[model samples]
Target chain A: MSQLHLTDEILMAFADGELEEPTAAAVAKAMAEDPTVAKRIMDFQQSRRLTRSAFSMALMPDVPPELQAAVLAQVASYEADGDSKAGSDIKPPQDAWIRRKRPFMQMALAASLAAIALALGYFVGWQAEPGTGGLIAQLESPLVHHELNSSASGKDVELPFGRMRVISTYRLANGSLCREFQLRSSTEAAEAVACRNSHWNATFALASPISDAGYTPSGGGDPMAAYLQSIGAGQPLVDEAEAKALAEAGR
Target chain B: MPAGIGQELVALLPRLRRFALVLCRSQPLADDLVQGACERALANAGSWTPGTKFDAWMFRILRNYWIDHLRRMRTEGMMEDISMQTQLVGDAGEGPILSRLVLSEVQRAIDSLPQEQREVLVLVCAEDLSYREAAEILDVPIGTVMSRLARARRRLMEMTAAA
Candidate 1:
């Protein structure tokens, strides 16, 4: 059995600060004498520094106060609704996400909403639907039966784009329910809103993908872009109650 | 199971976000991932056992969930856009000393790396997880971890260099 030297594993350990005193000491000793090895180590550190800096810029995104409020309400509901293991299944809120371009735009959207809210004299809280508006909403959506047929549980919900893992759920003004779901692939996640009207019209009200899990969604690849585009593109934004509720909500 | 795991999860948000940033490069998704893991941990708190580091346990769950998420993404694909790293580089903003260098060239290089190597680098350098802990979190043998780390670092260096 040959001893481990600058093996990829050892380098990884070194990078992670995992090497024990003796082992790390050995790697350190090797790196000192080996300029190539030392340079490699430096490169790793640089990646860390740069990556962290870029991502850190997006920690607090611009989440709409209404959506935030909605999430808060739904979160409360989630807490009160169950006790399988309190706090064991909690999800982070929209505001807490690490953001990049999404924060700025989300903030812009939020600002616009706030302006509208103030104009209308309605104190719309920020945040979106947590759980398909309500169970009723989810079941009624085009994707509802599809979702349930696939597996619409607390953990994972099947959607058109893919299987959406339920991060949280909330209710909306138009009798539409919504919840944040992460698509199975990539860093993209969005809220799907549906109303409990026996024919729940669940739609990807909006979607955004993070850099990973820390940064906010960008505008281009954002599913929200599609939904928003479809709206302006003459595609009716809502099928039934969601449209009405969105109207009332000034969305 | 231990008490106050929820509080612990709340505290872990920052670090977890950082790790997720490296893995997926998106904040919302990262938060979603954290929430998913938190919810899972809370639901399965009984399995955590007393005396275990809640942080590690949560991380293990998080890493597991993250892997599953990745697998799903690979099969179904996702909305495509300029990778976040590219968007950052385009900024060229006159920010702090560090932020300037965080632009696209290096990030692209990192992105180009294989998933295994990228995961190791993020877990180790970015997240600062020790080898043993990373191994546990990744559900890989220690040797496999070490090798992955080495390969990731080497590849990172090459990618960062003039291409």
Candidate 2:
């Protein structure tokens, strides 16, 4: 090995163990003979050590709950789409995945609904009265109108019952448009999925308050999700496709 | 498009967020970056080679998003100030106070580096990715990775030592 001074890149690669054996041996021999070479190598090593120390995983904030819920919801939505498409014959290797994922999806969906409540500037105490079939009847026109025209980032509508907004729109396998929506009253909230036919029909409804606490969906999973599965719901439409869907429906 | 890619993505969120936070220096933007990258990764999961490093693939997706965002911001005259103070902090419930203090100082040093240098430093030093892996993620040559890593470390050492 010649006694030429090592470039910082060479020293760093050597320090990082990125150099080939022969080049690394030359650098090792140089380091033994030259104190400055040894010091330079030590600097690169210390810098990496210090950086790794500073940004230790322990320094990280807990992943925010909303972000976690959002990711879980995404995974669940994809899983639901796969389930609807794959059918009975294509069994997933992990049977436990189905068992473990449902409650989580429902919980995440519930949490997101509650988060929407917060985002919509509604307080948590107000609970919507259950079994208000007449309210659904009265809500039919505005809900259908909004479903036809509004984007998934829905506009807030003041209803006789409460403020309601469409959450998302999806197409079921049988070729019908379905929308998931939420209604918040002064003290309570509910989320429902309505599919279009001759008229929009509420296929699934959960009358729980739009709060994370004290609300677990019936059957240890979301009936809305199960209904979507039973009906073979596709993924939610993107904004552009959604606009096109609305335009076609309007025509 | 591995069977467990979704779960793998979930596992990587913390480190992904850390890298984003280090690069963008904003918590909200970091979250957005990570979320956008994950969505892109899932939507185009087929494009990823089955046996390659999943983390590197994700980092590239995230870095591309960051680049696109910066381009959009610049075109729209909404360019962010890169010198924004980072929100990194030790958990109040854990770690020694000295580590917390050192963390802030080191974070400041990292924030002071150019974006290019900071990214290479984080990938190589903090994330423990090899030079080649970092180069692949950055879409730069291996030599560029080496030079950038050297300059970034030297600057970081100078700044921290001075502090």
Displacement of the residue A232 alpha carbon in candidate 1, Å: 64
Question: Candidate 1: global Cα-lDDT?
Answer: 0.48
lDDT digits (tens) for residues A1-251 of candidate 1: 24645755555445434456677677766665665555444344444444443344343233334434443444444456565443433232222111112224333333333223222222221112123232223334456444422333356654654566644333444434443344443434445433334443444344323332253323222333333333332222234443443344432
Cα lDDT tens digits for candidate 1, B1-163: 3555555655566666556545555545665676666666666766665554556566677777887787777778873332543332223222343243344444566667766777776665545455666667777887887777767656655654443
Chain A TM-scores, candidates in order: 0.31, 0.42
DockQ of each: 0.09, 0.15
Lowest lDDT sum, 10 consecutive residues, model 2 chain B, at: B89-98
**Colliding residue pairs in candidate 2:** A126-A186, A126-A187, A126-A188, A127-A187, A127-A188, A128-A188
* True-structure RMSD, every candidate: 24.4, 25.5
TM-score of each: 0.44, 0.56
So what's the TM-score on candidate 2? 0.56
Candidate 1 at residue A173, lDDT? 45
lDDT digits (tens) for residues B10-79 of candidate 2 = 8898889888887787777888888888876776666665566778778888888888888999999988
- Summarize candidate 2's per-residue lDDT along A1-251 as a digit string, tens digits: 35656899998877666677688778777766655666566567557756776666656556677777777777667655563222222112222212111334333333333333333322212122223433344335664555445555476777667877877788777778888887777645566677777666665554444433332223222335645655567688868887777666556
